[model samples]
Target chain A: QQQVKQSPQSLIVQKGGISIINCAYENTAFDYFPWYQQFPGKGPALLIAIRPDVSEKKEGRFTISFNKSAKQFSLHIMDSQPGDSATYFCAASRTFGNEKLTFGTGTRLTIIP
Target chain B: DTAVSQTPKYLVTQMGNDKSIKCEQNLGHDTMYWYKQDSKKFLKIMFSYNNKELIINETVPNRFSPKSPDKAHLNLHINSLELGDSAVYFCASSRGLAGVRQETQYFGPGTRLLVL
Candidate 1:
């Protein structure tokens, strides 16, 4: 299965709070998982990525927790700010094959002050 | 400087008309790709090219064609465009074709095409 299912089609969080989004994949062949952030009228940009070997990755205030056995991954934003509001998408891909990233349905996150 | 650039950011056309969207990457990447984002916000990969060689071609219609003149450029051409063809087309590129260990792809601003 090439599909990557993402939950909470939309999320609302208050400033200084934490916002989390989860995703799951059926394709075990996927070795690379990445999250993308897209602002209105712009292209999706890579936010954070993780490999199966690592269970967690933290970059600044953004963290990605990955589960190998469960085939799940999540994105956590600490101290959520209004600027962080955007559409987040989870994607998966195998490096050796076609190297095409299978994207999720995307989650629209709103950070309210 | 812009890493990936696309021409005709917005295209509005009538049915049966043909159109082409051009993409170029200044990142000197070896691989490039074309994606279509439908109204539902689903980003689907249409084609990918590595070093001017076609690598991946999704289950797109025959009316759509992708041409890569060189490693820096990949253009998409559509024939007999239909109403369903209206969507945002994005062009992206990576340093290499290997994804497991490749750098994040650089994406263009995207070209929105409206077919009437």
Candidate 2:
């Protein structure tokens, strides 16, 4: 079973539209949640990360809405642009000592200009 | 640039062949990791090295071995590659220090391996 499950296998949005991707995790041990952006033939880059302590964390136009009670977290891109086109992955890590992260399946987001 | 880098961005070999992928990080991080991303894009951690010590070793096959020559380098060697071994391998690094819990890893471009 996948520890972290991400929704919307793929998403399409017009430029300046709001794009949202949701992820649910089964493990409550997960304390650290992070989102990664990956382009074709490139490594996934760290876009934004958050701890469950905060209900929400926003960086630039990317925001992470964390629901501790529901064990869910979502990434919201405000005013999505064509440059935001990439595969986004949500990951969870338990202890700080263990860097082994449980990554979600992945969500492909395409922004049309 | 100051980042984690891996060699042979692309590797194509036949089954039963032995190959190795080298990784180096100039970020001066104390910990390094090897991750395998399959065709389905499911990324899994295979191994991790802290400083010069072998730390996390996932339930992987014995044929796959990770060698850390020094603190700055970690190489992955595969003996008798199988079709199942075809995937994109990524090398990542992160800081390891006391009182510092969270560290975002920097990943290399990735090495695509195709086993025929």
Candidate 3:
């Protein structure tokens, strides 16, 4: 069973527009939620992360809005640029200090100029 | 300098052949992980090691084996390669586990394997 589920397998947005990706998780034990970005050939890099205690966290133009009761989280990109075209993955992990992370299916986002 | 590095960026071999991939991390991390990204771009965890010890092993095939000689290095070896095993494999390391302040994982470029 997939612990985390992401919606919109692919997305396209115009430059200067807002891009959003949604993710939902089934496990309530998950406390840490993180987002990763990957280009064509490189590895997935950390974009932004948020804990269950916070409703939202923002870093630069990237923002993660988390809803604890709903067991959902979403990533928002403000001022989407063409360079932002890439795959994004949302992951969830428990507080057991285990390095095992349950990753979502992934969302391919493209920003058209 | 690369925080995590993997050897043999690409591998192509016959179905019955065996191959090994090496991974190393210079970030002085205590945990290492192996993730397989399939054609549909689903990143799945295959194995994880902490402090030179096996921590987590997912529902993978028995033909796959992971070895950690030390905390800085992790290697994966596949025996009797199958066509279904063709995918991109990634290596990652983290100072500590998630749910902590320093739980971010650094991933290597990745190794693309194609089995015929």
Candidate 4:
């Protein structure tokens, strides 16, 4: 299946708190996993991504944890702020030649001020 | 300038009408894709084009067709549109068509279709 399942359809966190979103995939052929952040009335933008070769990737305040055997990955946002409030989607793509992505349902994260 | 751009950000039409949404990507990427997000917030791939050629066409209705005039543009044309066709459609692109999943995809702001 092309589906990348995500958990916690919505999330609420306080400012300075940690925000976490989880995703799982069914297609083992998928080689690339990416996370997207989208604000209201905006398109989804790349937040963070990881490959099966590496177990984790950290970019500034955002980090992605990947587990190839589990076929799962997660995005962790540290020091979450109100500006970080938005929808986050986890996606997977075969990418070896076909760079098409299969997106998750999306998680609406609201960081309370 | 926007990396990926689309026309008619919002479209409202009556049932049985025909509509088309045009998308253009300026990122000079080699691959382009179309995704549909429903009211439930579920985003699914509809079609994909590479170098003005069809690469992927999901199990979408025959009423829906995609046309690629060039490497920078992909347009979706729906004939005899139905109420069920209402959703937000997004266009996206990536740099390389064949890689080990290294390049990141750039997404366009999305076209919301409201079929009345």
Model 3 lDDT, residue B10, Cα: 99
Ranking by DockQ: 4, 3, 1, 2
When 3 and 4 are scored with TM-score, the better candidate is: 3
Which residue pairs of candidate 3 clash?
Answer: none
C-alpha RMSD between model 2 and the true structure:
1.5
lDDT for each residue of candidate 1 in A13-57, tens digit (9 for 90 to 100): 999999999999999999889999999889999999998888999
Model 2 agreement with the true structure over B1-116: per-residue lDDT tens digits? 84888999999999999999999999889888899999988888899888878888999999999999988999999999999999999998888543357588889999999999
Q: Which candidate is the best by DockQ?
A: 4
Location of the lowest summed lDDT over 10 successive residues in candidate 3 chain B: B95-104
Candidate 2, residue A4: the lDDT equals: 92
Candidate 1, which segments miss by more than 4 Å at Cα? B98-100
TM-score of 1: 0.97
List model 4 lDDT by residue over B1-116, tens digit each: 98999988999999999999999999888888898989887878899887888888899999989999999999999999899999999988877565444478788999999999
Clashes of 4: 0
User: How high is each candidate's interface RMSD, in Å?
Assistant: 2.3, 2.2, 2.8, 2.0
Quality of candidate 1 docking, DockQ: 0.60
Q: Lowest summed lDDT over 10 consecutive residues: which window, candidate 2 chain A?
A: A93-102
Question: lDDT per model, in order?
Answer: 0.92, 0.91, 0.93, 0.89
Report the poorest 10 consecutive residues by lDDT, candidate 1 chain A.
A93-102
DockQ for all candidate structures vs. native: 0.60, 0.58, 0.61, 0.66
Which residue pairs overlap in candidate 1's backbone?
A95-B100
